[model samples]
Target: MRKFNVFIVLFTLFSLFISEKAKGFEQAGIYSAKIETNQQQQRIYGTVTDQNGETLPFVTVLVKGTNIGTTTDENGIYEINVPGNVTLIFSYMGFKDYEISTDGKTKLDVVLLESTVRLGEVVVTGYNTVERKHLASSIESVDMERVVSRPIIKLQEAFAGTVPGVTMLQGSTLPGDVPASISIRGISTLQNAEPLVIIDGMEQPLTDVDPNQVKSINILKDAAAASMYGSRGANGVIIIETHRGTTGQFKVNVNSWFALQNPLNLPKFVNSADFMRLRNEAYSIQGQPLLYTDADIQSAQEGKTPNTDWVKEIIERPATSYNTTASISGGGGVGTFNLMLGYIEENGLNKIEGSDKFSARFNTNINIADRFILLADFYAHRLKVDRLRRNNDGHGLYQIAWRMNPTQGIYYENTDIPNHYMLHNDMNPVAFINEGGTWNYMYDK
Candidate 1:
């Protein structure tokens, strides 16, 4: 590989030598004296020596613009004949490039330091690159490897495990949905809990982005970095950069996962006997008539005869989730192209129903020339949801299940009331489920 690289470099340099001899010199300068001074051109004499006081070998001395150049002799000395005002460049592969004005001086003695590209400082501000020491603001960077390390379903999920001031609050009331609360530097508003999300140079809502498509996520914290973005950045700005291939190689990567989730914080509801006791206490305080007979009262005093576990009945054991993603990317001299497809299946604790999603994405970057670049991207997702129940908030499920009398069975078996509508105002979980009062089918794209 080293030999191949050397060959390519030498071949290109030789081609430049044979194609033309540099000759763009013109009489374009200030006065007649300056023109007269360039009659025979001038000579810049320089000696190259290593740091240990030993003469260095084979240093190339060239004029800045024109490709007219020569190498030092074995003694590490060279004299280049050029215009007195021209710029002389001293360069060695491992040493820093030195440019000097060939005016008002003779015997130029140049000291060069070892060039360290990898250890040298690099700064990334937005999409621009500058020296690390030049930045005055506090900007954080997340590399590609670190972004993909987590088992994240949404692009925002990667931030959950990484950022310090950022907090993620998963919604307990709604399970299969994405995280509802994401705050940076604490919650700034009761109306809006999420920060601003930006992809490339365009702005987007974080909830609309998928993790599989992202290459990195950068969180710009503090006022110094956030102020430039104006009002939209009061919450903070999450910048996302997607992956693209180089000009010659094809890159393919696949990511997939299967997850099982039980409820993180499941609420415990009182059993039928305790519930009835509380209910009787409330009725007594309100001066209402006794709703239960002596036999029902006897059953309620015992811990268990037929107590309903309302929370358990509504929430199933665990839900299963699976996500798959595949992408193909390649490029040549003309341009680069990328295509990706993703599918997700999520099931909630409600055993009868779940949510499914499928998405497709397209991205392409073209090098218009050596100095210009063009990028284009578009993506869309289709979602379908099958839910056995709609949350009428905490009121529907809890109000019904907690108040159902322990004496009554799920069906009206051997009840003296005889009519299903007898307790129309009373909370009944079985009736809510049977009467099709809690079901939903949603399609969003």
Candidate 2:
């Protein structure tokens, strides 16, 4: 029995030794054998630790010379059998690459630096690269990395508070008509001060271009900077560069976001009493009958009929807005082509009224004959505003509530109120509201 027990123990020890040897054999393959025979054998073992000293899993370990590679396990430990004189390469995206040599060491730890190309690198100017050394021209280049870092749906939203000297006023909330007024470097011309926008080498209206596809936006301010654009540059010039394809296999990218757009600011109007007083003054000065009796005037004074804040009443509502884009880009040594499709849906700030906007853009670019290149882009947009009314006309919401008679019933035949005559064709404020007219205004002719 003692001899049998001793034999069993020996067998168990032999099995374990064989198992370990098998494992070693599996790790050291044909490549390991070649290196061993050449007297250039190396057994490199290392642990990849992050900045927090925690083991990094699946870290790639490569020997620079012979294509011998291995990956670290969950415990952040890796082993590579290579020739002793070869260098090992370690790399991970967003981290600097590390290279080391094997002289006899068996353990190593590497920490990587975070890559920030935009912050430290030079920015592209016109044709050359310029270190932002203040060329002095009121030029404000919106930080693309900062703005793009946040998952923003619209490109215009990127201009929120970054563009110095530029003002963005929220207009309507309608998807396409999200009433926004973009004024660059202030209003220089009374006639039409809005700047001319050139997107991807194509001159187009700002409203026609959706912000979802913009990669970067650079604003050229100051007369000297904009002079190159001629008359259209009087207001200023905004250059929008869209995203393009990168070199590699074909790739697909989808960018989508859902957001709620509500009124950021609503102009305050006079209270019923204050509103009534202003109207009565205009009536008396115009030699018109007292439109409101004490009671009728009181109703308006106490927030009754004829005194309702129509602008607030009609325009205060929440709306859902969103943008989505799908893009594919990739190519070979010749060049690359990037394609993108995008869409947006939104409601206006007006509670019950709104607008719908649909837009499509296509950009195609290629190297014509090596040194010379050509790019073609087209943008088309359609807008439809429901509950369309002249809210900004002289006799529109404001003047009607401010200068019209307060006591007079909203509508009465043979009314005794005076109408605006300073402008010959100026219609009565009441008629302008209940009845509608049109003004001849066209620019694209």
Candidate 3:
């Protein structure tokens, strides 16, 4: 009986202890719920703009002392959920960081100021890279964004009307021909005035470069700017730098454009009747017999004569061209890579003349031992050009076409050789173009 009494007393004490613990837990739960109810989450919205009142996209907006963050959209708008009395941070490239306190308010708009110091901008010269402000010589730099904006057949064509004191004179419309005679600061020398072109420290023709892979192009106009090249800097210097991968996430870019070309401001040619009258007048003035008889002139006036528009026959209408480029770039802990592929097809005003180019480039930078960096660049391209067969005298078909008589027909009624058209004065422009066969020149680099 004594043992039973002791057991009952212990049981009663244990029950009382359990009840006190349950009450404490209930009070703690109520306190936590009240705290959570007081800390209400409010939606914050704002726009980020630059000092010039321009919307700044891709700006990073973050809540202070927390992992919550968001980026501004293309329209510079952002929304976030955060507690009161918290601060928001805004940051972007080339701009000063901005911070605003919520202070129990929901909406906050910010205008970031531009960084005053621009010494970080670097320009690549042939020998080395220097800060743009520190460079003492006259150098003009063009970035890839500007270079690839236009539909250009050759790299040299990108300089048209863009570079100061530079003139690009296109002498021929033939495909794959050297684009234009590039003159910097007018004629710098009496002979051989072509500027020296350097691509990644190697002398190369601008035509061989793929504009899609270019990172930047710098032109050294003054002797001091190009003195490193010695005698090659007499005329001027063009330094081209290809793109290299950066240390970040992977990126892909695709660019394409289609264009049509037609002859601009072409002179109007005389009709058959007018041509005959002019020929007769020229013959009479030169004390020679009339080339066309009265019957022929009458027949031409009556639209019975076969008068072909030679220019129209030789020149193709609405020549079409297209260019496409795709590039992939990425970087990791120790290495980075960039690969680009490009294709271009340009048809000339002449049916038989056209050019196609295929190009590939790979650039890589490997960090060795966290100290040394190894950079490798590989580029290759194949260019195929189709042109007319030139005469033995080395005159191009277009040149001969200009000298041919407008009154002649493209073909003859009878010929000894099968599938061969008649020749006029040892040359027939149309027949030569149609029957001379195809001439293709291919170059790989």
State which candidate has the highest lDDT: 3
lDDT of 3 by residue, 358-416 (tens): 78788888878656878888889999988777632224765777666667777664677
Report each candidate's C-alpha RMSD, comma-separated, in the order given.
14.5, 16.9, 19.9
Candidate topping TM-score: 3
User: Could you tell me how far off, in angstroms, the CA of residue 382 lies in candidate 2 after the best superposition?
Assistant: 3.1
True-structure Cα RMSD, model 3: 19.9
Clash totals, every prediction: 0, 8, 0
Q: Give the TM-score of candidate 3.
A: 0.71
Q: Candidate 1 on 321-365: residue-level lDDT in tens?
A: 767776767554346677676777766666545666666677887
Between candidates 1 and 2, the TM-score winner: 1
Residues 316-344, model 2: lDDT tens digits: 55666655555656433245566565555
Native-vs-model 2 lDDT?
0.58
The window of 10 residues in a row where model 2 has the poorest summed lDDT is 436-445
Q: Candidate 2: lDDT of 398? A: 43
